[model samples]
Target: MSKSKILGSTLIIAGTTIGAGMLALPLASAGIGFSTSLLIMAVLWAVMAYTALIMIELHQHADSSATLHTLAKQILGKKGKWLASFAMLFLFYSLCAAYIAGGGAQFGDRLAQWFGVEVSATQGVVIFTMLVAGVVTIGTSTVDKVNRLLFTLKLIAMASVLMFLAPNVTQSYLLSMPLQQGLIVASIPVIFTSFGFHGSIPAIVRYLDGDTPSLRKAIVIGSAIPLIIYVFWQVVTLGVVNQSTLLENQGLSALIGTLSSTVSESNLAGTIGIFADLALLTSFLGVSLGLFEFLGDTLKKNSANRSQALNRSITGLITFLPPMCFALFYPQGFIMALGYAAIALAILAIFLPIVMVSKTRKLTTDVAYRVKGGHIGLATCFTCGVVIVCAQLLISAGVLPALG
Candidate 1:
């Protein structure tokens, strides 16, 4: 359980969790009232953190090479594999769509600012997709190397945002949010989507060589980083942009677009653009790698031996194309895409962990770590998962404001 291993592992998880899902945070949570929204984020943070631990616990006790797909089959058999595969594929694809769409929006804005050229959203997506898909297909070793570098740029640019906006903050902006009573439920899906670090559990386990203690440490530290960043990010974004504006531009595109219009200073808008581009790229790399590896594992395309490692390029197409389609067609639906992703991820990340851990405890009765609170905690997690899934579905069905 070395600190360096834990740090690197933590970054991997943090990078995975803190991506496109967050691009819409201030926009999504602003209308909920900063006070009320923080509460929701904290609750979901606890729930997602607890679920991540269950996943780590399950990973530690299972086979050395087991992924969510394989582990699901070991506990629940072929049916489990099918359902798990579907959930995982859909979740990653939906996230890819959101990230690509957001990245394109940023790219288009940057191009206009730097080169005085305007690009259509579809053209922007096509350009951004070509760049990101190239990086993703170059393989995981390359992604890991590049992600660590861009991650630093993302932090510096973001820190500047807080610094610039912090001085202008007024008590009025912080307390001025209009809390919609019925609309609060919409934030849950976004929160769930934001705190999604479960997809990287397998990578953390393998990175730490399945050291349960180190894995546990990574889960807590990794999740905490994003939680803290989100709090500060939301505060600054709230203070910078008026609360009344978010209520109008619920979609990530509209919300972020509104930021440029509201901020009078060019540097402020420029810094926001730089931060968004760097953040989206790093997030794209981390999550896409996680999903790509998951797909490889499920396809049985990986190997412990270097020589046996299958270089199936088609997997790249399968993983990136669906998202590109969504990016091309629904370029403005960043929030909508994330809400749909939450629906799929809730089943995979939350519910599965509870069921698998319960079965693991009953069958083996041996593990280095176990999630506390027993059945009650698990029931709470399950119930919360159901609520989030239903919330996303209801929004998608037009029963509520389609917050996208």
Candidate 2:
């Protein structure tokens, strides 16, 4: 693949990984050890990156148009298709709800600052969703191009924020809190959600025209962006502010608000909001691409079909509606929605890849890259997935308190 195509693919993967999830990371790492969280983030990145390669390995030998819908049917038959399709949609729906909630709140807050007017969270959700719907309904090429630009903007915004903070950091700003017992363990599910980039593999395959080397490199490089960003983000957050401050606020906006006043001439809050908004937009673009294409492929109404536009409409509505409703009605459910999404990731990104790779390993053309360790890695990853599911279940059952 060309450098431009590779960069675009990298942006899609990295952009998807670093969204609403990262917004909550500072708060999520409050009680947990920052080093522990970093270690967990690294492991999840490796696992998620490995699983993505498995998806690509499967995609390389299949039709160029094949997606989650196509692979599940080819590997696991009709029953698997039903299971995979529902899992895919359910996960994306949960993620969209979280993004809408996150984006709407950020957008509303910034707009309110700019105009000296109050924008309700529901209004924010509707505004963001309508704009996102326009981009999503247009299809992948547009999303790809738009998201690449958004990714660039996201970096610029982040760089600006970091630069603004540089003069403010002092030796007194650095402090380490004692880790609460069981908090590190409780944080795994939330941390796992931050490394989610598997859903974009099919889009990568299509975008790169099935260039295996580029796909592998893209997954690794794309995933690494979040890892580095997350580490730097947590380091800045943990060192610059106290855990008590994070505990008082439900979201990162509070931190941004605190830091906003540090500079008199600049609208730091608006600058921070731009980063959050761009992150939300890029993530929205990617998950929408995955969900719509998966549904369209399931119904056999892909870009090749005469009714492609109409098919995308149907797919976009199916993918976007439930989240829109949730965001409008329950605008403050960002953290909750993300916790639920992490629970689902155990099944879709974790367990499913293991099973798919194990079942299809024999069928894969030797030309494609295979997940190393064969059955051994699958067994290990499945065990890890089970542990995540169990932890999530604990949180759901009130055995463990949910983190922010």
Candidate 3:
């Protein structure tokens, strides 16, 4: 792949993975103790990397020009297509809603702090949702351009914040672990959420110009970047904020607030807020664009008129409404719901990758990337995904506390 293509793929993966979840990861991991949380993070990275490789293989058999919907139809048939489409739609829309509501609440909180205004959280959510909807409805080209700009700004802001604070993270704090049981389990959702790059697999594959080797390298490298950033961010956050405060606050933005107080630097809090918001916006836009792409393709393929306007409106509504409602009534649940969705995505990533690898053959009978352990590698990936999903379901069902 060319430098520009690699850069684009990395941006897509990073933008998709960072989003609203980054704000919440530290708080979610607070209960699990830092060591256990890091362990879980490592496991998720390996699983997602393997899944990305599987997706690359799957793409080899899929039509290079086809979108995820078409790929699903080809790989799994009609029912499979419907199932995959529904899952993708549900995942992205729910996430967009969460981002809108969560981003608004965080952004509003910062704005309120800065301006001394009292804006209701729900009002903030509505404002943010409208902003996202307006941008998405305009066109993909506009969204793409906005994402690229935001992505650049986000990286700069995050790097600046991290660099300034790097010296303050004490060695003792880095080594210490919070005492909690279910915290790790509860945090699985957030860990999985941080690795939520599966939605971009099709685009990554396509961008590689359908070169299997290039696609494999891109996915692995792209996914690894976010994982490293996430773990390092968690370390910094944990070191900066006390575990008790993180647990008590139970939100990433809240943790940032607490850290600001501890550091006695309001500017640090503001910087984190600005960068975090930018990251969330880019992430929401990327996922929204991908969702719109799949939906637009599906509608055009299945319907006669292919009414782009109608499609945009419906897609906007689907992506906007539910999370807005949840934001209004249950804004705090946004991160939790996002975590659950991540687990579900992990399942899809693992299953689809292995299935595609097993079913497809090389065009020239020369495989570019092969699973080293063969059947054992496949089973390990499958089992890891199953366990993650089951654990998540249990956590969500109230049968288990996520941390426990």
Report lDDT (CA) for all predictions.
0.79, 0.75, 0.72
- Model 1 weakest 10-residue run by lDDT: 303-312
Q: Could you tell me the TM-score of candidate 1?
A: 0.90
lDDT of 2 by residue, 94-163 (tens): 8888888777778788778788778777787788787888887886788888987888888898888777
Q: Least accurate stretch of 10 residues (summed lDDT) in model 3? A: 360-369
Candidate 3, 179-216: lDDT as tens digits: 74555566776677778788777777777778776676
Residue-by-residue lDDT tens digits, candidate 1, 271-389 = 76677788788877777886777676655544444332344355677778889898888877778888899988898988888888988889876666777889999999899999999
Error of 3 at 137 (Å): 1.0
Best by TM-score: 1
Q: Please estimate how well model 3 matches the true structure, expressed as its whole-model Cα lDDT.
A: 0.72
Flag regions of model 2 displaced more than 4 Å. 1-8, 134-149, 166-178, 206-211, 261-269, 289-318, 362-368
Model 2: colliding residue pairs: none
Model 1 clash pairs are 251-404
